[model samples]
Target: MPHSFALQRSSVHSTAFRRLAWGLLVASWACALVSIGLSLARWAAIGHAMDWGRWLPVTVVPAQAMVAGVVAPATMDTAWRWLGVALECIPGLALLYTVLCVHRICRAFLRGEVFGPEVVRGFRGVGWGFLAMFVASLVYQVGVSALLSWLASGQKAGMVVLGVSSFEMSVVVVGLMMLLLAHVLAEGSRLKAESDAFV
Candidate 1:
């Protein structure tokens, strides 16, 4: 009777773990899509004359696919094509990392094992990395606009418009907010670890 009860409990735990994993996967992909969409919208609003061509969809779809299955490539390049590649890879990497962390957390919880402080620290690091990428992209957009405007009309209005676009500001704000949320999650994880250790 006890053996049967233990088996049933184990099955329940496994089901719970699977549910948690699926939830994490969904959330990660949704966040990735929203972030990438906002970025593309900002670029479209700013670089009106530049042809994004295959770059826009290339950047977004690959990142989404990475969330769904494989990890995207991460080769660095300065060319516009390579820039699209890098954009896809950056979010792919971030989503992969987050998924892994969430998986670990779920497994530990299912096993009644305490998650370590490292998990929290990893979350914070990933968040900060995303923030840095957003800032760098924004700066790049501004710089490109400035150069193009200077070449055309000797005025910085293009750069200013690019810098102050609604989408750009939202991206910056959202990135910062995500970073803050990561820090909070990390602290909470650390607290949980400490509490479990005490018990």
Candidate 2:
């Protein structure tokens, strides 16, 4: 009965939303810090890195053909390594953006600004962030493939690989769903304003 009572208390806006606000703020910052630390570690490892190509998306040649004297070690150096690291970090950055938007919405709820313009905008921002994640993933795959390919064989332009996986398609669906939610919130806000004016 006590557990059920706590569950029931969660239905109250102020209690639940304040909890969510603080929880998300803490978790988001923690994950963002971890991600940055990992990225820095990877960047620093670029110098003495073997099997680094295993961390990257593989660049396939047509028919898996290998020209004689082609570079086989699969290495990235100089500006290429920086680009690779930046590409790897982009998805994390996108996720951070989404969390930031969620944090904003949570803050609004904590302040009793439920269904306010800030929350609506935050939802839209998160929707765009999800879409940005999908886009960034595509760019990462393509860019890494191209970089690896060019480093392998200068004459080969065989990096035209393109395919959509379940995760990519799933994020698109989620992004659209978030956008729909934002639209619904906008409509609800309109109705609320109308009712308030009527009152």
Worst 10 residues of 1 by lDDT: 68-77
Q: Model 1: per-residue lDDT, tens digit, 120-171?
A: 5544555555555555545554444343334334332332223334654665
Candidate 2 per-residue lDDT, tens place, 1-199, comes to 5696466455545565678778987887788778667755554454343554687644322211233222222454667667656766777789889888988887787776666689899989989999998997777666655655666665365353345778899999999998999999999888878876976
> RMSD per prediction, one decimal?
10.9, 7.1
Index of the highest-lDDT prediction: 2
Residue 111 accuracy (lDDT) in model 2: 71
RMSD of 2: 7.1
Model 2 alpha-carbon drift over 4 Å, by segment:
1-12, 47-76, 89-93, 152-160
lDDT agreement of model 1 with the native: 0.50
- Per-model TM-score on C-alpha atoms: 0.41, 0.71
Candidate 2: give the clashing pairs.
Answer: none
